[model samples]
Target: MSSSLSTVLLIARREYLERVRTKGFLIATLLIPAVMGALTWGSATLASRAKTTSHVAVVASDTVFAHDLKQQLGSSAQDAMQVDLVEPTTASRARLDEQLQDKHSTLAGYLWVTSPATAGALPHFTYKARSAGDISTKTALEDAISAVLLRERLSERGLSHAEIDQLTEKVTVDTSASGNTKAAFIAAYTMFFLMYMVIMLYAMNTARSIIEEKTSRVFEVMLATIKPEQMLAGKILGVGGVGLTQVGIWMGAAYAYSTFGIMASGGHVLIGLTQVLYFIAYFLFAFFLYSSIAAALGAMTNSEQELQQLNMFLVMPLAFCMVMVFAIIREPNSRLAEIVSLIPFCSPLLMNFRLSLTQVPAWQVGLSFVLMTLTIAVILWISARIYRVGILMYGKKPSLPEILRWLKYS
Candidate 1:
């Protein structure tokens, strides 16, 4: 490489090592994964609990209905739930309501079955819970009640208990996707989210670092050795290296988990060698695209607060990508997905989403990378022009017209 390029890389290395050694960087790098892992583990544990200690009351006009509801509720809860069957008298209903309103109420919730006016009409359910946020508990109650009603209906039709059970048996939904759908979904969703977060994270970090140097007058000294474009390149590359390092650590952790059998069988299907390669390619182009814009904006700003006011321009695209996530997952090969995958701002995530959820054609994948790279190049040129003039600027932030004039002058 040329000495100039080597100098740029040297600056990049210095920036990378400097940030990587900081207490804030170390804490964030380690904390993000640790928190994510804890949340994942906690969610799984809560979902897998065999029995919940909920105290639920079931009330119905018919003793049989109340008893059946109670039985179903007990069976469905992961924990040994305390379910009480009560006759639906006005006094009994009022008593339950009072208990629920009590400050020291031990009752979790109550399921009230409104008896149909006629045998032809179906019953209505009114569930009151102390906490409305327990979706799993509510889902379990709904499923249990539905199961009980189905059994009752079948029994009324003269079907035996065996017949009811056999008819109600759950069916497995197999997919043609290369791996287990759950594992694939988890992997795909995680990768897309990580890509978006990493892009925004490093881009913002570049902006903050640039503003820091600009405010502290360090750029005055650095400019003597390097051009504004080189400084921008070095900062982008240096900060980009930190992001890559974090991703590498996470990837290594995933590999270790898979190797030790911590993950389920076919976990490798989610992150094959092909996916990793695509990831690296997309990450590099995405980084350059956003980081270039951040560097230019940072060059113009004198304070971090000033930079924040201009974040909407950068944030909108990321938000748009998030909104497109469901569509890409649902129909990876749809016309909309294909069109979106070619869009420079959305392609990195949408294209990766397609690759993770479904098999994207090699041609489409290559086209996405090509389109994004071209877009990145264009952005870098525009940002470089802006940076060339903007770096020496200080005090008041420039307006849109002033920035446009700077672009022309540069």
Candidate 2:
């Protein structure tokens, strides 16, 4: 490579290293995962501890099996819950209202399960809210009530315990599908998040760098030393290179973490080394396309105030890409999803979304990359042309037509 090109790369490497080495970066790198780990541990401990205590509120109805039912609930709840049985008490209408309103009530809803008249067939389930769970809460309640009713019925029919056991057989749901659903889910969603974050990060930096150079009049000096295209190339390459370096470092750290976890658990580990190549390829094309546009826009503006007006042109598309995150997850193989995934402007976002949800074909992936590269080449040429002369002009940002004319003239 030429010395100018080398200088650009060196400058980029320094910029990337400078950001990565900062205190903020170091704190964030360590803190986020640590906080997440703490939350996971804390939640598990709380859940394990919660099941041992049952809060029961008995209303104005008395029955033989109330304490027994409460006991069953406590036992079934697994942490060996101690039942806090609140006995029924009579009060004035206003006093009853006041008691119900009290927040300190140790009540998991009122148990009217043993109403003498209604306790024949199906057991009563009246609580403050809906049932707590699918298996342990809902099923447990039904099964307990059913056992009691079955015992009563068997006593009436003169049947034995062995006959009751024979009636309760086995039921199961065996399922199978020819798909890597979990991998698709991870890959496609990861792609969307990766694209969304990286694009926004690099694109904003590109614009800011352009604005800085333009405001400082460094572009003029830089222009004399090198072509605008080369300057644009170097800046994009440098910033983009820095971004890739950070990604590489993060990936390495992630892999190390994964390896450690796998060894601890005695499990196989595959850190997905191949995906890095695809990541770099797509990122470079996306950067060149986006950075050049931002640079050209930066050249046209003399001030930050002027740039703000032009910001919407880039911002809206990114917002659309973000909105599609759900759409991609919901229906990965939709026509709209497929079309968007193929489009050069939308590919980075949509492709990532599709990547996470489905097993994309090689042809589709290859074709999208080719089209994206072509689009970037065209955009870079246009941006370079406009930037060549736009850097020289001052005041009154050019209209689209005016910019086109300057690009032609430049």
lDDT of 2 by residue, 127-192 (tens): 442225423444444555555566557766887777865675435343224223443354345555
Report how far residue 400 has shifted in candidate 2, in Å: 1.5
Put down candidate 1 lDDT per residue, 134-239, tens digits, no spaces.
7656877877777888899899999999998899887767553466677678878888988888889888888899888987888889899888878888888899
Which regions of candidate 1 fall more than 4 Å away from where they truly are?
50-53, 57-71, 76-80, 84-142, 175-187, 254-277, 395-410
**Candidate no. 1 TM-score:** 0.80
Off by over 4 Å in 2: 10-72, 75-82, 85-191, 253-281
Number of residue pairs clashing in candidate 1, backbone atoms closer than 3 angstroms, sequence gap of 3 or more or interchain: 5
- For all predicted structures, in order, the TM-scores are 0.80, 0.73
Model 2 vs. true fold: TM: 0.73
